[model samples]
Target chain A: AQTVTQSQPEMSVQEAETVTLSCTYDTSENNYYLFWYKQPPSRQMILVIRQEAYKQQNATENRFSVNFQKAAKSFSLKISDSQLGDTAMYFCAFPDYGGSQGNLIFGKGTKLSVKP
Target chain B: NAGVTQTPKFRILKIGQSMTLQCTQDMNHNYMYWYRQDPGMGLKLIYYSVGAGITDKGEVPNGYNVSRSTTEDFPLRLELAAPSQTSVYFCASAGADTQYFGPGTRLTVL
Candidate 1:
């Protein structure tokens, strides 16, 4: 079984400030991919960043980066210089065992508010 | 390219009604998926297709059925609607680890 956990239900960050959203996952597989998706008012699921379990380096996308602790089963996202456009719900996800295209297991999600 | 497209942007159905949500991808990806997002929650997989004529159930498949006659299309069917079935349905196509999502369909069951 695979599970992803996002402990924060909601968070607020001022513009230009930084905020970090935490995520922890459980997976028996030695190789897999972890993802962060952003859902805004439009309800579109947008891929933010992804981290491979075998990689020692964390993944980064412009202002968004992840602190991936593979041994601790943790993958946390950090947004630098927050903007109002960053307000949305963030979800951590892991693919079910099989391959990269397997079913995705998602965390409940954390609603983020970027205050101007 | 139109990565993934879903029909019926929004719909309202009475209890016990039936409907089919359409999804099409122009990317010709061999892997496609259907997921539903309930209010205040993350998306849950309902079904997925590896290729033409190949389909499998996912995390939440009880109230839904799906078919993949061609690589470009994967439609999800709801035989009998219920209030609990109200959710935003998303269609996605993946070439590898990353999945490209459709805009989504918001369905309300009355």
Candidate 2:
């Protein structure tokens, strides 16, 4: 079984600053996928970014990026130029190579507050 | 396109009551999943279906039942509801990598 851990319970960042949310996982498989999902006040789960384990280079999308360390089983999400709209509960998730189709194991979540 | 729709956005039930959480997707996705979200805890898979008539248990399958009679509809049934079952339920559909999630149904058991 794979488990995702988000050590940080709550985080805050000033507007226009940068913030990093930490995440770690336990897994023996080499092929897998990591994802960062955001849930705003609306309670809608939105995909922020994703990283493939085979890729050495980190994945970047707009202001969201991921620091994926396969050896350490660590995949962290970084948000740059943070804005008030970015405030939400962020969750880290993982999908195993072989198992229930597209089933994801998620961390408890980190509540991010963007201060103006 | 109404990618995925869940009925009865909110509901309240008494202990031992039974109800069904309806879910439907218009994407014609082969895979559909049911997950529950609690305070401070991220979503946990309750049930999943690879296709119509094929359902499997997930991490948290107790107190829950699901059926996939058609490609678009996958409904979750809860029998003898308990306080522990009070949480937000989300239905999702996927093709390969990305998944589309519904607005979610919030259930309260008192």
Candidate 3:
């Protein structure tokens, strides 16, 4: 079984600053996908960024990026120029592309507070 | 487009009762998913559908059921509700790799 772990249960940062959320996973598969989904106060889960394990370069999306260390099974999210609206629960997910029934395995999440 | 919409933003039911959470998508997506998020936790997949007439159990499907009769709609059914079933349910529709989620249904089983 693949497990995604988010060690930081809660995090806070001043508005316009940067914050990094830690995530690690245990998977034997060499090829797969890692994702970061943000759930805002509205309870809408939105995809922030994604990275393919086969790629060495980390993925970046606007102000959201991921530090994907395939060898160490670590996929952390970095939020830059954070805004107050960025406050939410961020989940690190892994999609078992190696399986027939591909399902997302998610971490417990890190509740982020972008303090104004 | 409405993307994905879940009916009854909030619902409460008694133990042993039954109810179906409705989900519909307007983007003509082929894949739909049902997930539950407990308080202060992440979302867990309950069920998913590849297409119409094809549904499969996910990580936490023991206490839930699902059916997909049309490409636009997928409904999750709870035959016998329990207190443990109290959680926020999310419905999502995806095309290829990116998934679009609904506002979610907050369900409370008393």
Evaluated at residue B69, the lDDT of candidate 3 is 91
Candidate 3 stretches with Cα past 4 Å from truth are: A98-100
Q: List the residue pairs that clash in candidate 3.
A: none
Candidate 1's residue-wise lDDT over A8-102, tens digit each? 99999999999999999998889889999999999989999999888999999999999999889999999999999999999998887854357
- What lDDT score belongs to each candidate, Candidate 1 first? 0.93, 0.92, 0.90
Per residue, candidate 3 scores C-alpha lDDT tens digits across A1-116 of 78899999999999999999999999888887888999998888998998988889999999998888887899999999999999999999887665425578789999999999
Interface RMSD (Å), every candidate: 2.0, 1.0, 1.6
Candidate 3 accuracy as lDDT: 0.90
Residue A86 in model 3: lDDT: 96
> Residue A17: error of model 2 in Å?
0.5
Task: Write model 2 residue lDDT over A8-113, tens digit each, in one string.
Answer: 9999999999999999999988887888999998888988998888889999999999989899999999999999999999999888445677898889999999
In model 2, which runs have C-alpha deviations exceeding 4 angstroms? A97-99
User: In model 3, how large is the Cα lDDT of residue B89?
Assistant: 96
TM-score of chain A of each: 0.96, 0.96, 0.95
Q: Per-residue lDDT for B1-110 in model 3, tens only? A: 78999998999999999999999999999989999999888888899999999998887899899999999999999999999999999998877676778999999999
Chain B TM-score against the true chain B, each candidate: 0.98, 0.98, 0.98
